[model samples]
Structures are given as structure tokens and as C-alpha cells.
Target: MFDGIKILNADADIQKLMYSSVLDWNSVVNDGTGEVVGRTAEYNNLTLTIKEETSLVKVTGSLHKYANAGIHNADDFTPERLAGVLDSIQKLGIGINSALNNLEFGVNIETPFPPAKLLERLICHQRREFTRHVSKGFEYYQCEHERQFVVKIYDKGRQFGLRSNLLRFEIKVLTMQVLHKKGIGIYTLSDLLNQKLYPKIGNLLIQCFNEILFDEPTIDTTNLSKKDSDLLINGRNHKFWRPFSESNFETKQKYDTARKMRYRQEKRFRQMIDSSPTAERLHKLAAELIATKWEILSNPIVPLLHYTLNVEMGQSIIPTAKECPITGIDISDQKGSSRYLSERTLKSDPELLKSLPVTIGQQRRRKHHHPEEYYVAHNIRNAASNPRNSIKRRIERAVKNTPLFQADEVIRLTDEQKKILQSVPSNVPRNKKPR
Candidate 1:
């Protein structure tokens, strides 16, 4: 999940590594004195900026691309892959304790539809409007200008010309204190080398995603009472709801009033969705996205289909004893009756396996190794509770029927789609001026 990292105060030996590994090395000269101060070079996805006088170097590039041979980052950056990358850094005389200046971590989720639709539905994040930008000539959407971090949601499939609906949702942490605030004890690059920190990182990603307020234009409200329907429809209009979350008041009491009113509005909207039958699909879709992301963060090697089987067939489908997905070593005995370890650790690493708290209660409380499995299974078992179509069941069926990989098509929005996009709050069109 690690991508686009920046490291500062790199060692002088890094210059040697760059000489061997990097391409297009050029001298950065002092414009007035014509004396060379530093050198800049570009590798496939790694950029190196070196100041020879101070031995201070700055490295900024996509660690994901480096791991994938500079191809694309649509695939998972597994624990094993990260270890290998860390080893490469060590070889370059960069300590694992090297402090990162900036960090970006996110997963590429395979959506069922064009990611542009999801991007279009994004209204705002934490009362901040998402700005549209063209990066490297490719269009993407992001919510930025916050001091701590930026929330980015972009079409990975379109960006890399991949044949999948790869929607990349990532948090670019501008300040390391943000991670500390989130209870993620990651100070150095080596801290991330451990498998334990992944869950915390994944939690941060999900929290950022949840903070984004989405406008579901396709929600159905036909069965609702007049008042309920009006609320449902009007709540989705970004223009109508933006004022509630924004604090324009001069006095503290007035600000508190707006805060209380905003909370009430949000509660009402959430209550409506929870109580209404039409929102079942939206809830399931959200659950699926989060569950799938957690599953990948927990165990990237296992295929998504394996979870599908666990949901559909339960333990009867998986063998009584399961081997490590990476090394194929037996670990079923490690977790007692549970077929697999919750955080799939390599059998070769006994310390990692032993690190797991094996108490029955802790075991039960452990994050599911297959989060999507339990999620889908739970929803499938309770399918009859929902009057509308079972969103989980539909998703399962679709996944089962669809090919593992398929080409993502360019999105050509219909007139109706365009209208919905235009209605989204704060998303001013290129040709229009902000009111």
C-alpha cells in the first residue's frame, strides 16, 4: 500500500547507489557562481536530489512502482514485497531508521463500476470541497489544503491504462504528527517493516474515506413519506447541506449553534438511511468496500475469491489445515481450530507467529483473516431481513460470474449523469465561475 515516499538527510553512499541504479543524472549548478552544488537523477520511478556539500539528499518517488519494476501499482504491495524493498534501501546505506519526510499509503480497490462514477458522487470531505486537478496530463480528484494530510481518490485503471476498475483511495500524510494522533507509532521507515502497523494504517485510510460525504444521486425514495422523501432528496443536494457543516458565525455561541444543528442534520440523514429500505444497497456497497480493503491489508496474497468461497461454503470448503499463502507452511495448528491465522504471518518467521496473542478471547477478537468472508456471510445469512434485493448476494454472484481481470472502459457520461455531476455541491465546471 505504500506509495510516493519522500526521505530526507540520506547518506552520501546513496550517491553511489544512484550512480548504479538511476538514469539521466545531471549536475545542479549554482546559477551565479557556476559551481556544482548538487546532482539530480531519475530512475524508473525514483527521483534522487543530492547536495554534495552537506551530504544531504532528498529522495521522492513511488515506492510502489519500484516494487513492481516501474510498471504500475494496481497490484498489492504485500509485506514480503515491502521487506524486499527495505533490503534494497539498506544496501544503499540508508538505515531502516531513516525518517520519512512525507508518506502516502492507500489501496487500489477494484470497483464493480467505472471509478469516475464514484469520483463524481464525492461531494466534500470534512466540509472541504474536493478540487479537481490534472496531474501529468491525467485528471483526478482530491480534497486538500488541510494541514495534516490530503485525501485523494483517483482512477488508477485510467491512469495506467489497466484493464480493471482500479480506484485508488490514498491519504498523503503531510505531517507525521497526523499518524501519531491516529495512534500509529510509525516514526521511521523501519517501523513500517513490521506487519503489525498495517492494520493501524488501514484503519486510518478507512477513517479518511468515511469522513468524505458522498451524494448518492441514484438513491430510490419512492416508498418514503412526503417529509421523509423531501429530506432524503434535499439532503443529497450538496448546496443545501454545505452551510450546515461550515462555520461562518463570528461568535462562539453561534458557532456552537451551527455545530449542534449540523450534528442534528447529519443524525437525521443517517437515521433516514438506516431506517429506509432503499438505502440497503448503499450500506452493503460501503461494507463491501471497507471489508475488501481490510482483507487486503490483513493478507494480500490470498485471492478475493477465496473469501468468496469461505462466505458461500464456510469452513467445509477450506481444508481442515491451511498452509501459509506465501511459504505454504502449515499454520493451522498455530491458531488452534481456526483454519488460518488472522494476520497471515509466514511460518518461517516463528517470532511473528508467536507474537499473536493466542488466548481464546483475544483470538475471537482478532480481526478476521477474511473480513469480506464474514461480512458477506453475515449479510447473506440475514438476507431475508432486507426487503429489497440482497446487495451482498448480488455482488457475490457478480464476482463469481465475472472474469478475474477485464479491461476498464472510458467513461462517457450520459446527459442524466452530467446533470447529476453538475448538481454536486462545490464542484464547479471548468467553464463556469464560482458563485
Candidate 2:
């Protein structure tokens, strides 16, 4: 339902309101950038999204989503929630214009002005317009009039055509077209947000469109009513408004053939009447004729250009949750169910409960461990591990155990122990004796 239409600019206040409505199962937040994105959990049909940026807050959820949410009332508008959100924003002083979707209407038209003649006067591009529907032999040029409206005109042949669009005497103008015509001087949307600029730009465009279509001398047909002109000009609907009927006629002949037959029959019938003796009585029949063309086309052709203009009107907002209330429930900045640690969720095992703190404390201390405890544990482990030193110690122990050293009550170092200790120097001796 959303047709790529959105409010590009929004105040932070409006964004804050949307943030509350977003569901939090898998919500994401970035404190560094102050960006928050969330979708309404309950309003699943319509994924209401909210974005909080540095300059502006953006809230986007088209009315189509709400209509699909099954909240329709038989007699009321199909998607009533859209109306509610519109009301909520309006209360915030944001113009309704900010949220309206774009509208487009067809504007194919005809005038005394041919595309070539119009091209001479206006800015337009050459086109190979398909004219097969109306008749095989017609050419036209399509171009922009005054660098404004999209205008098309038939050139080579006559016999109303199947133009790109059906003909209307009045031209159509779109909202964006109006803005383009206005160019640089018009007030910006930021001004509209501040309520300083006019919000009814669509209405303004409608006026400009009417002037370009109706008041323009080139398009104005002297006596034709717009409605009559439209019908008369768009007479090329051969298939839908078929020339032949089911009750009569051979195969469905071409539109030109049917037309030629009517003209010929009228001519033969007139010849028959004139061939009678009454032909000599024609000298007696005479009457006055005024400007018949002017008389018939006398009606003013009010150009009825189709316009589906965007309506934008925003109001002041207090910038809080109370500003725009949602139908579901009050939204909290933090989304999710309550984190209540009930008895069922608590640790039930006694040993696990007692050790939980110690486990947590140890894990916590790793980040901020005591320096003394670290080195004390490090010093207890022997790192040097000299192989020859170990052997010398083992030999000394064996010598002390012998009767030579243990002869007395006190175990003293014997000459054999000293010799065993001195046998291997701290520096390993490289010299070897061959036995």
C-alpha cells in the first residue's frame, strides 16, 4: 500500500514518540551515535519504524499497513489507525501535509493547437506516439508546454486519435510539477515544520494548473464546452464503443469503412431527393445563417486538469509520549517484559548457590588481579632446571649417606662428598678422557 511516499523531515520529539511504540525482542541501540530503531511489536501488520538521528527524527509507517491490520469498522474508514496517528501528529503541531502520500492523475487533452504548432510555441520533445487504436494514419508531437505541463498534440491527420491518454479539454497538473515551476524562491519544508511557510502548496499548484490550461490563448477553443470538446475529440474508442452491432453487419469492418458507408448513403439519398420534380422547387428555399461555428462553440471551456495534490499541514508538539498516544499501550523507552527474578528462576542447588559468588568474584578479579598474588605463585615454580646441578646434588646426598660421613653423630661433609661436588664444575667441562 505504501507508494514510496514518506515524510523526509521530522523533529526529534516526533521520533521519541515512535521509539516508545517499537517492540524490544531484538531491539538495537547505539549509544555512540544516539541511533535507535524499533518496530511496533503488536502492530505487526504495519511495521511502524522509528529512527532517532542527530538532526532529525524520522517516523515512517504508511496508512496501508494499518488497514491490513484487521482493525476495520464496517461504516468507518477501512484503516482507522491511520486517522489516529494523523490526529496524534496534528496535536503535536506537525502539519498533516507532512504525512500525505503523493497522488497522480491522467492529463491527456486536445485543443485547436496541434503538437507541431504547440512545439513552435512551447518546449517539448519528439515522440513516436502510437495512433493505431484511433486510426492507422495520424502523427503527433509530445512536449512540455512553457516548460511546465506535459502536453501532446496531433499533427498529420485528423480523425480523433488514441493518444497516450484520453483527451480532456482541461489539462492536469501534479503537486511536484507545481513545485518545480515555483523553483528556488518558495519557502522550504523546514519552514513548514516551523509553521512559517504555507502548507497548501498543492492548492497553489491547482490554481497555476487551471491558469495554464484554461486561460492560455493557444489551448482555448472559441465556442466549445470542455466536456463536449473532450468527448468529441476522444472519439477514437472503436473497440469499446464498437461501430458494428451483433444483430447486423457482416464481419466487424474497420472504423474508417463504417464511417465512409454512412457518408455515401447520405449522399445517394440526397441525390434521389434532388432528382425528383421537387429539385426545381429549391429556388424557393432560403434562410439567414449567423456565425454557426461561434454559436456552437460559444460555451466557455473551463479546463478541468486532473490533480491529486499532496496536502501537508503540521502543528506544534510538546515532544513527549503524551504527545501522540497509541491505541495499544503506553510505550516505555526500554522495551521488553519485566526482569523479575522469581523463586522459580533463582538458583535452587545449595552448593551452586554458595559457590556462585566465589566463581563470579574470581572471574571479576581477572580483570583487576593483585600484583603480589601473581608473583608469589610465579616464584614457587623452578624455572632454571640445570641438569648438571641436579646430578651433583644427587651425588652429594649419596656420599652423606655413606659410613664415612655418617660415622659420627653429626653428619659432616666428608672428603668424598667434597670431591663428588667438585667433580662437575658450574661450567660443564668439555675435555673427555678415553678409557
Write candidate 1's Cα lDDT for 285-341 as tens digits. Answer: 543465445434555444222321111113222321344322223565565433333
TM-scores for all predictions: 0.67, 0.22
Error of 2 at 74 (Å): 13
Screening candidate 1 with a backbone cut-off below 3 angstroms (N, C-alpha, C), the clashing residue pairs are none
lDDT of 1 at 81: 70
Q: What is each predicted model's overall lDDT from 0 to 1?
A: 0.61, 0.30
**Candidate 2 on 60-127: residue-level lDDT in tens?**
44333344443421111211233344445444334454432222221122222233333222211221
What does candidate 2 score on TM?
0.22
**Candidate 2 Cα outliers beyond 4 Å, as residue runs:** 1-4, 14-48, 51-55, 61-85, 90-435
Task: Please identify model 1 stretches exceeding 4 Å from their true place.
Answer: 11-15, 18-24, 220-250, 273-287, 300-335, 339-435
